[model samples]
Target: MFLASSAKPIDESLQNLVVEIETQNPDLLVVAARQLRYSLQQTNIELTITEPRPFNVLEEFIIRAGIEFEPAPTPQELASLLGLDPVFVQSTIKNLQKLQTLAPKSPITVTEQGRLFYDKGAVPQPPYAVQIYAIADSLGETVNFQAEPLNEVVINLPSLTSILQLNESNNLISTFNLEQVQKNLQASGLGLHVPETGKIVTAFRSIGSTQTIWRKISLFLIFDSTTEKLTIHLRRGKQMLDSRSKWLDLLLSEGKISLDTLCKLPNESLNFEREAAKKYQNAETAARLEKIHQQALGNSQKKEVIQLRDREINQKFLEIINTAKQQIIIYATWLNHLNINPEFIAALEALAKRGVSIIISYGLEWEPENLLEIKEKLQAIKTPEDLPSVQLLGLEEDVYLQEIIIDREIYQCGFYHWRNSHESHIPLGELVYQVKKSQIIQEAYEILSTRCQNYAQKLWQQAVEKCDIQLARECLCIWGTLGKLETSLNQIQKNNWLELLPIYLNVVIHNLKSHNLADDSPILQSSLLLLSQVEAEAAFIEQLRLAYCQLLSAIAQQNPDTALNLLNNEVWAQFLRLHIAAETDSPTEFISQQTSQPKTKRKAAAPSTRNKKTKA
Candidate 1:
C-alpha cells in the first residue's frame, strides 16, 4: 500500500496504499483491523508497504469503506497543507527532519537509486500501450472499448465494487477513450470508409538484374452490405480473409488494431500469394516487345547517301538515264559540269531515243565563257528521231541548290564544289523511296508540277524579249541618228503612215522639250517635214492635236489641266500655221510662242510635279 500526502485521514491513507499495491498484483488481501492500526499512528504522513500480497481482497475492503486521499496537488501545497493537521502530522515532520540531519545538509533530492526503488514498489506498470477500437455491430450499432495487451475492457464501471475488483485483479487493463482511438487509427492510414469498386489498383515494384521485389503494400477496401459483416481483402493480391465473427463486429464498430495482430487471427485465407505471381509475369513480357521495334528503323536509314563531285555525278548519270522510264526533272544552278562530260550527253540521247521525256532546268545568268562552251556541246547532240521531246529551261539567277529528281523516285546528289572537283571525286549516293498514292501526296504533286511549268514559261519569254531589245538598240546605234529615221518616214504612203508618223513626231517633240535636241535642230526640221507631207484633213489635224495634248498631259511636269490647255493651243497653232505658211508662206510664230510660254511658267512654279512624275 502507498499514500500521497500526510494530510489525508489515517484510514484514507491506508486505503490509498492498499489500492496502489493491488492494481499491479491484484490477488493480495489485507485485514481491516490491521490497516486501521497502521493508519492511526500517522496523522498526515505518507506510508508505503514494500511487500504485500492478495492485493485484490485489500482493494475490495478499501473501496467499501469510501476512504478519501488527494495527490501531491502540484507538489508545492504539500508541506503547508500537511503542517496544518494536528497530532501525528507534526511527529511525521519531525521524523523527516531527523532523517535529513543524519544525511547530507543539501536539499532532499531523490537519487537514481531512490528513483529505481520508488518505481519498482510504488507504481503499477500498465501491461501495454492501450488502444481503443470502435466497431459497428450487425444491427449498425457502434461499440468502443480499449484493449490492454490481451484483455479488452469497457470504458465505464457501474459501481465501486467492480472498479476496486478489476483494478486490483488486472495488471494489463485500462478504461477506453474513443477520441484517442480515432487519432491513432487516422495516423495508421486505415481510412474510415471503404473505397468505391473497380478503381484501378496500383502496385509498386523495384526491378533488379535477375529479379524484381515488391516494395510497398496497398489495397482498396471493398465493402458489401449483403455480407452483414466487414471482411479484409487484398486488391493487388488474391482472396479475401474471412472474418472472426466476434472480432469482425468489434473492429467495424471499434476501428483499428496492429496489422500483425489482425493477420495472426484464426481465419485469414491463403489464395493472395497466387495473384502476386501473375503480376510479375506480365511485366517481364512488356520489356521484350520494345527491343524489336528499334532494330527495324536502324536498317532503313543506312541505305541512302549523297554524291558530291561532278565526275561521280557524270558516272551516275548513265545509271540514272538507264533507270528513268517517264519524265526526268534535272534542277541545277550550273550547266558547266554537264557540258564537260560527253557520256552524259550520249546517255541523255539514248534515253530520249527510248521515248522518255527529257527536261533540263538550269539557271539563266551563265557567264559568257561558260555559255560559249555549253552552246558548242549542245549543238553536237543530234535530235533523237523517235523521242517525243527534249527541252532546256532556264531558272532565274536568285535560285540556289543543284538537285535532280529522276522519274520522281530517285533523288541524286547535290554539288559542293570545293569538296568534290571534276578531277577528284566523291560519290554521295542516291536516295530512293516508293511513292504511295494518298490524297495529301497527290495534291502536293499537282501543285508542284503546275508551278514548275509556269515558272519555266515565264523565264523563256523574258529571255526572248531581252534579246529583241538588245537587237533594236544595236540597229539604232548603226543608223547614226533617230533624225534619219524620221526623214525616211515621209516617203511612206499616207494611209500606210498614220500610226508611225504620230509616234515619230512625239519622239521628236519629247527630245526637243527635254533639250535633248535643239528646237531648230535637224531632228525637229525632219519631224516637221514628215508632218507637212501628210495629206492633212481638218478633222484629222484636230484629232492629232487632241491626241498630242493627252500625251503631253500624261508626261508634263505641271498640273494636267494646265499642261493640256498649253499643249492643245501649241499643237493646234503649229498644225494650222504649218499649212498656212506652206500655202500663204506667212508664219504664225507669235501664237506658238504665246502657248509655249504658259507651259514653261507652270512647269517652273510646281516642284511637286517632279515627284509625281517620278512616282508614275
Candidate 2:
C-alpha cells in the first residue's frame, strides 16, 4: 500500500500507462512505484569468533625449548644452547613475556598458556565482533542475508500487520553459520580469508543481540488492478530481474507464489458486489465465448484457430469442467504444472466427488517427488468411497501434442504449455486448434485412453514380473486410486487377476516391513487402499477387501495378546501373512511370472453409436 513519495519523480511513460489503464477499467487502479516499505528490528549482535592462527618458526622453537628443559633456561642460556645471538633471543623472550606465554623474570619459563600453545600447533583467537544483516518478508520467510544492509533507507510508515517473530523463528538466526558469516564479512570488505572449496577455519558465536529496525528499499511495482494482489517482480538497481535468474527464482520460491496466484489474484477491492457479472461484461471474454458459440453452431468437426494465454486456457478449462457430465480426458506434458493452479485442482476435486471420470495422461518424465505431490493433492480430496475414477498415467514415448477432450465432445489442441506458460511473456497469437467435430472428438478419446490405459496395464505387469516393487507400487496406485485397467478378462484370466492381487499386496507389505516402516505408513495404507478399490469379479473384489482389512489389523496390532490372535485365525489373514513373510524372507523372488502375469489378448470394445456432442 506504500506509494512513491516526493523524493522521487515517476517516469512519464509509466504515468501515461497507469492513467490509460485506470480510465478503461474502473475496477482496476494502476500505480507506478519505485520504493517498498517494510519493518525490521536493528539488532546489535555481539559475536565471538575463534580463528586458527599458525605459530611462527621462532615462537614454536622458543615454546618447545622451554617445555624440554627441566629448569627454565635464561635468554642467554637459551641463545648459547641454540648457537644464536643473545640480543635476538632476548627480544623473542620479551615478545613471549608480553603474550604471557613466558615468565617476565630472568629465567624463561613456559607459562600455563604457553604450554597449551606448544601442545596445539595453532593459536585460537578469542571472541571478535561479526556484523550480520538478514532480511525476512512479512510472512517470516528468510530471503538473502548479507553483511551490508540491502535496504539502507529507514522510514516510519502507517500502522500495519507486523508479526513479532524472533523467538519463534530461531532457525532464521541459525542460517548465518560460521562459514556463511565469514563470506558475508569478506563481501563487506572485512578482508577475511575465504577458502574456495573447503570449510573456513574460523569459528563464530553471537552475544548481546540487538532489536530489528524497519527500512524502506527502492523496488519497482507495477500494479494494474486494485482488485488483484501484487505480483512481485524483484528489481536489481535500474534493470528488472531476468525470468531465468537464480535470485529471482529464490525470491519466487521463498514468496510461495503458486501458478494460481500469478494467473488469477483474489479480488482485493470491495467496490463491486457482482464480480461474476463484471467478468462476463468484459469485451475480451465475451468475444472469445461468441467465437466458441459460432464454432459450435457450424460444422461439428471444422477446425478453427484461437489465441489464448495460459490464464485464458485455465478459464476455458474451467468452463468445460463445470459442464462435464460423464468423463474428462486431459493429455499434457506434465502434471506438476497443471497441479500448480489450486482453482483448477479444486474443480477436478469437485468433479471427482460428483462421479465424473477423470483421466490424466502426461508424456514427460515426472520425478518421484512430483508424483508424490500430485498423489497427495488428489488423495486429500478423495472421498472414502473414491468416486468418479481419477487416473493419472504416463506415456513413456515422445508426446508433443497438448490436448483436452471433455466427455468426447469438445476438443482443443494447442502449442501452449498450458499451466506452465507465462501470461505476460507468451506472445498473443500462438496457434491452438479448436474443433467440435464428433468424429475428431471420438478419435482423440480413443488415442488418449487406449494409449495411456494400455501403457499403465503393461507397466503394472512388467513391474510385477521383474519384482520391481517401486514401479509396481506406482502402477497399482494408478489402478487403485484413479482408474481400473479396463482390459476384458476370461474366467481363467479373472482368476489370475485374483491370484496376482495377493502377490501385489504381499510385495507392498514386504517393501514396507523391509524398511521397518510403521503400520500406518502412507505406503502401506495407500497400497492397501488401492488394492481395496480395484475393480474385478465379485469373489476377487471380496477377497481383496478382506485381505486389506486383515493386513491393516494385523500390522496395526504388533502385540499377540490383542486382535493379532483373532486376525491370525482368519483364513485370508493367514494367507496374506504367509505370502508376505515368504516373499520378504526370500528378498529376491516374488510371485513367479507363470502365475502373476495376466494375458492381455482381448478385443477392444466397439465405439458407441450415440454421439453426445459439445462445441469448442
Candidate 3:
C-alpha cells in the first residue's frame, strides 16, 4: 500500500504521538488520536483501501474502547502479549473488525467467532496449506508425489491398502463450478459419508494430458462442521511405473478411459493427504465462489483496456480533451460545473489554441441557456483565430449520446457531472472505454453519430420553418381551448390555481387591472379577448357580485362574532346591508325578504342522553 499523498518526512509532533501511543495511557492516546492535524493525514492511502485510514481507525478504536476507563492498560499490561510490535498490534486489531470479530475496547474482547478460530489455532494449526503423496504405475518404482500448484505428501503403500484408504474418505461435500475433480462415483453413491465424523469426503483423480499419459493424480477434500474451514489434499501418482501406474495403463491403453476425461484433467494437479485436513469448513456454506481459470488469446487481453471509476473518470476526461488536435464533438443533455474547474478550462483553452474546432449539441429544450457559456468563452479569447468555434447543433428530439464523447475517439460515460462537483458527494460511474481503430468500431461510430446528427438537422429545420404567423396561431388555439382565464379573484382561489401557479395568474390579473392588457400581439389579444367575453356575460357578472353577499350571510348565520368583524369593511357592510329586508315590492326587496323568514333545521339526538353522537 502506498502511504501518504506525497513523499515527505513525517511531522515530528505526529511521530511523537505515535511514540506516546506505544506506551501511553488511554487519556494520552485519546488526546493524540483526536488531533485533526495528524489524524487522517497521518496516513494517506493510495490504493486498495482495505480499511478506512488506519490511523483514524486506530484512534477511533482507542477512544471507543478506552472511554469508560479514563486510563486503561497499555498493550504490555495484558498477559501473553509480550514481545510484540506495538504499531503492528494496533494495526492488526484495527484490521480484524470484520463483522464484529474483534471489538477494540479496554481489555479488547474477542467475539464468539474470533474465540472459535483462536480455540482451533492460528496460521499453520488452522491449515492454510495441505500435502499428499501416492503411487501411480506397476513398474516396481518408488512412489513420489509432485503437483505444480499443490504440495506433495509421503505415502508409500501397496495398491490394496491405498485403495482402501481412499475409499474410507467418503465425504462428498460439494462441488465448485466446473472445478470438480471428476464425475466418477460408486454406482450406489453410498459409502461417501465418513462414518465416525459424519462428514463428506470427496475423492477424485486427475487424468493427465495426452502428451503425458502417466501423469494422473488423486485428491480429496474433507469438511468439518464445527470448525468452519476447508482443508484439501492433492497427491500425484508416482512418475515411476508401478502397480498404480499399471492400473492406470490398463484403463487408458485398453481404450476404456474417455478422451474427454483425459483432456479435462489438469496437467498440474494438487495432491493433498488426509493428515493435513484441519476440517474447519462446515458442511454448509452460504457463499461458494465459482473458480474459472481461463487463458485469453488475440486482442481481448485485459491490459489493452482499462475502466475508469468516479474521480478517475473525471480526471481522465480532463486529460483526454486536452489532447484534441483536430475536432471535438460533445453531445450532452446537461452541462456540469466544467466551466468552473480551472483544470478543465485550461485544458480546453490549450486544445482551442491548436485550432481545434469544438462542436457541442446540447439536447435540452433550454438550449440557448448554455449558449451564454460559449459566448463567454469566446469573449475570453484575445485573438479571433485562437477562439474555437462553438456551434450549437439543434436537435429535433432528445437523441443524445450518453457519454460526453470527444472527436469520436475517447469518451467518458457516467452519472458524474462536471457541474455537480461542488456538491458533497459525487455521482459514481459505470464505465469509460475508447474505441479501437478497427473497421467494426469505426463503422459503429459513424452509424450512431450520423443518426443523431440527422435527427438533429430535422429538428433544426422544423424550428426555422416556424414563421411568426404559425407561432401566433398556435398560441391562439391553445389559449382558446384552455379557457381557464380568470374573471375574478374568487374563480382563481376556488380553483386553487393560485397555489398551482400563482405567479402567472397574478400577472394576468395585474395586467388587466393596470389596463396593460394590450392586443399588439396574438397571445395578448387571445387573453384580452377571453376577458372581454367573460365581462360581456351579464348573468355571470351578477352571479360574481352576488357570491360575496351569499358568503357574508352564511358566515354571519354560522358565526355571528366572525361576521361582526367582517361587517367592519365598508364594501362588506354594503353587501350585507343589501341583504336586509324592509317591506317593498321591488326585485331587490323580494330577494332580501328571506332574511326575515324563520329557520327550520334540527339536530338528531336522544333527549335522555346528555352527550350524543350522530352518523352522517
- Model 3 sits at a Cα RMSD from the real structure of 36.0
lDDT of 2 by residue, 1-616 (tens): 2222221233432454445444554434333233334445333333444443667887777777777766767788889988999999889778777656677886767776566555666443443556555444332444334556554555664211222122432334445666665555555453443333211334554445534445443333333222233334433333544432333335545864332223222333222322432442344333544555455556454444344454576566678778876567777766653534567778877776565656677777854365777766664664223222456666754445667787677887654553224533232444455566676567666666666655666676576567664555455544432234222122113434444555345433332332223444444433433333344434454445444443443453342232222223243333233332221222112112112222321121223334434221
Please state the error at residue 440 of candidate 3 in Å. 6.0
Worst 10 residues of 2 by lDDT: 586-595
Best-to-worst ranking by lDDT: 2, 1, 3
lDDT of 1 by residue, 487-550 (tens): 3343223224343344344444433343334443444333443444545444355434443432
- For each candidate, the alpha-carbon lDDT, in order, equals 0.34, 0.48, 0.34
Q: For candidate 1, which ten residues in a row score worst on lDDT? A: 33-42
Alpha-carbon deviation at 559 in model 3, angstroms:
98
Query: lDDT of candidate 2 vs native?
Result: 0.48
* Residue 405 displacement in candidate 3 (angstroms): 4.2
Candidate achieving the largest lDDT: 2
What RMSD does each model have against the real structure? 48.0, 23.3, 36.0
Better of 2 and 3 by lDDT: 2
Number of clashing residue pairs in every model? 25, 16, 32
Q: What does candidate 1 score in Cα RMSD to the true structure?
A: 48.0
